[model samples]
Target: MLLAHDDEGSGPAVVLLHAGVADRRMWDAITPALAHTFRVIRPDLRGFGETPMPAEEYADADDVDALLASLGVTDAAVVGSSFGGRVAMELAMLHPARVSSLVLLCAAYRGLEPTESVRTFGAEEDRLLEAGDVGGAVDLNVRTFLGPEAGVAARELLTQMQRRAFDVQIAADQAVPGPAPRRVEVDPTAIAVPTLTVSGAHDLDHFRSVARHLAEQIPGAEHVELEWAGHLPAMERPDAVLALLLDVLRDDPTVHAP
Candidate 1:
């Protein structure tokens, strides 16, 4: 099924894949600017926003490919945040012809052993959900994902997005019970596109490690660590992230200083 998405502007295509705790709306702060220079496509992945959870087996990479195909886009630069970053890599590896470049923001890597902090966060989130404390779960995510640089508005926005995602996912779980979908681990060494992995110093060690691993494994991949960010730097400091994105997306070797 084609994912629900917003396609704006008219230039080279650029797709923004959101984090697990967020929907396409997470890109709202910078989409307008990006739209002026490129065709920006932001999709609500299944079980996250307007898209419903799949009733049958499906891969998110395939879903994204389908969405791009429907838009007549043969290839595009892709940016993914957090869990979205994993999906971005999957797309590049599985559908190499579809991706022109990749930018991963505190991305999650499949098969990476979770750090103690990450495990603790996951367990608490599960406990909250199992206890029917959806609000608490949302709060947990806001606290865990947002950095010190994040302002009140960012925190509130994350709270709303996380709450919405939980509502959609929880309702879907009640309607369809099954094991988690299988994921195909990406072979980073085979990725040939210009790739950049951005990590936040304040993020969990697991994600930082994943960023480094991707940079090392993916030939020609560049890694940048943001000193003032957490797991979700885009939300924490949209303008700064936007500037960074503009520099990289322009594909000017001299523009990307950091």
Candidate 2:
């Protein structure tokens, strides 16, 4: 199915996939900036934002590829944050010809084992959700994902986005039956496109490790760590991340600086 998306601008396609904690709106700060130079496509993946959860089993990577195909786009730069980054990698792996390049921001890798901090965070999130304290869960997410750099506005926006996500996902869980969506294993070494893996120093060790692994495994993939960022750098510092994205897209993708 074609996931709900916003398509703007008139140049090479640049798809912005948001973090798991956020929806397409997560790119609200940088979309307009990037759209000035590229065909910016931002999709609200299933069960997020404008896209409702699917009743049938489906893969997010397939949904994204289909969305692009419907838009008449064959290849484009794919940028993803957190879980969205994992889907971006899957897209590049499954639909190799459709992705010109990849930019992973605190990307989630299926191969890595969760760190202790990550496990604890998950447990707490689960407990809160099980107790039906969605507000608590949302607060937990904001605290964990956003860093010291996040302003009040950004934090508020994240709270809204994440809460909406939980509401949609929870409603779907009650209605939809049978297992969750499955992910395809991504082999970083097989990804041939120019790739950039970004990690935040303040992020959990699990994500940092994933970033390093991607950079090392994916040929020519450049890894950059943001000293001031947490998991959602795009939301934390849109200007800085936007500049980094433009630089990577306009110049040599393999070359970058933090």
Candidate 3:
């Protein structure tokens, strides 16, 4: 499947991966600027945004690689946030030649158990699901996942995008969507591409820990923390994120200030 993607501009390709909380629309704030310098491609992951769910078990890493192939892109820089980051890492791990570099933003790896707080939040979401209030679950996510500094507009954006995700996901799962399919665990040491990891200081400890761990594990991966941002720093500060991408694209050797 084409996966309902937006591909624009020209030059080296740069794929924008969205967080679980929001779909490809989350990159709307940054895409225009990126498109000016690179071919920006953003896709709605399966059962999110404009993409339909797979009939059988599917691998997100495969979906991404297929998308790029359909576009005749052999290799490109992949930028992913949160859930999208996991896909990015796996792609680099499983198909190292396909990814020129990776920009992991608050990304978590598979097989790692959820943090206590995340589990608590999941339980709360389950309760909302039991109550048949998907909107309530969305509200819970926006409050927890976004930075406390998020304003009314940011909250509104999250609410709309998250609700859309719920609708798509629920519609796809007639029966229980089975437990996660087994994955090939990622070894950060194996990823040799020039990599950068971005974390928001205001994000949950679990995510910050993932960021720190990835930075430590990946050889020479530079780490940057957005002091006032949260889990979705691109949404919180698109200008700074754009600048970071530009620096990487230009192969600037200067690491971001800690």
Candidate 4:
């Protein structure tokens, strides 16, 4: 299936990948800023957004590589959030030459065996969604995904994201699907490219822990913890996120000093 993408700007390529349940549209607010300095390619992941599900059973890395190749992108800096972060990690590990640097935001990497609190929250969310209580699920997700101190403005964005996720789920339900494969293994040490791992202060403890783990395991990976954000720092604090991303790309030895 061809991935739906939005491309803007005109400089070295910087690909943006969104989280699960959300589409490439999630990057809307942040793209304009990045567009001033770099070319951005944002694509909806398979089974989410406007992208059609692939006819073949493939891992996220495969989709990512295929998309990059389609764009004639031999190398680019990748910025991924949540599920997209996992794919970015895979890409860095499996095809190091294709990535100049990596930035992960509230990424899911360690595995599915999250802490009890996260598990409980996820279970409740799943139950609510499965029982057709989409509104309830969205409410819970906002509280779970955003920091308590997030501004009123951020809350509105959270609502928009929730609505988008619900629509994505509807699309997923209408498509032919099969059992997804288990999570793929990522060898952080194998990711030799410059990397940055970002975690929201209000994000699930599991995510924070994973970020720390990634920093330690990935060779020379930098870690940034945003004090007033949660699972989606890019959405809640786009300006700050963009600043850090640009700084990293500019200062990273692999990218700028090379």
Any residue pairs clashing in model 1, and if so which? none
RMSD of each: 1.3, 1.3, 1.9, 3.4
lDDT of 2 by residue, 1-258 (tens): 779999999899999999999999899999998999999999999989999886787888899999999999999999999999999999998899999999999999978889999999999999999999999999999999998899999999999999999989998889847327875989999999999999999999999999999999999888999999999999999999999999999975444677
lDDT tens per residue, model 3, 1-258: 678999999999999989988999998878998899899999998878989775577778888889999999999999999999998998897778889999999997754567998789889999997899998999899988888566677788989999998887776676465324337578998999988998898988788888888899999897888898789878877777788888888788664753
Q: How many residue pairs clash in all the candidates, one count each? A: 0, 0, 0, 0
Candidate 3, residue 21: lDDT: 86
| TM-score of every candidate relative to the true structure | 0.96, 0.97, 0.93, 0.88
Model 3 residue 5 CA deviation (Å) reads 0.3
Better structure of 1 and 4 per TM-score = 1
Per-residue lDDT of model 1, residues 1-258, tens digit only: 789999999899999999998999899999999899999999998888788786678789999999998999999999999989999999998899999999999998876899999999999999999999999999999999888999998888888888988987787777656325558778999999999999999998999999999999999999999999999999988988888888888977754455
User: Against the correct fold, how does model 1 do in TM-score?
Assistant: 0.96
Better of 1 and 2 by lDDT: 2
What lDDT would each prediction earn against the true structure?
0.90, 0.93, 0.85, 0.79
Candidate 1, residue 34: the lDDT equals 88
Better of 2 and 3 by lDDT: 2
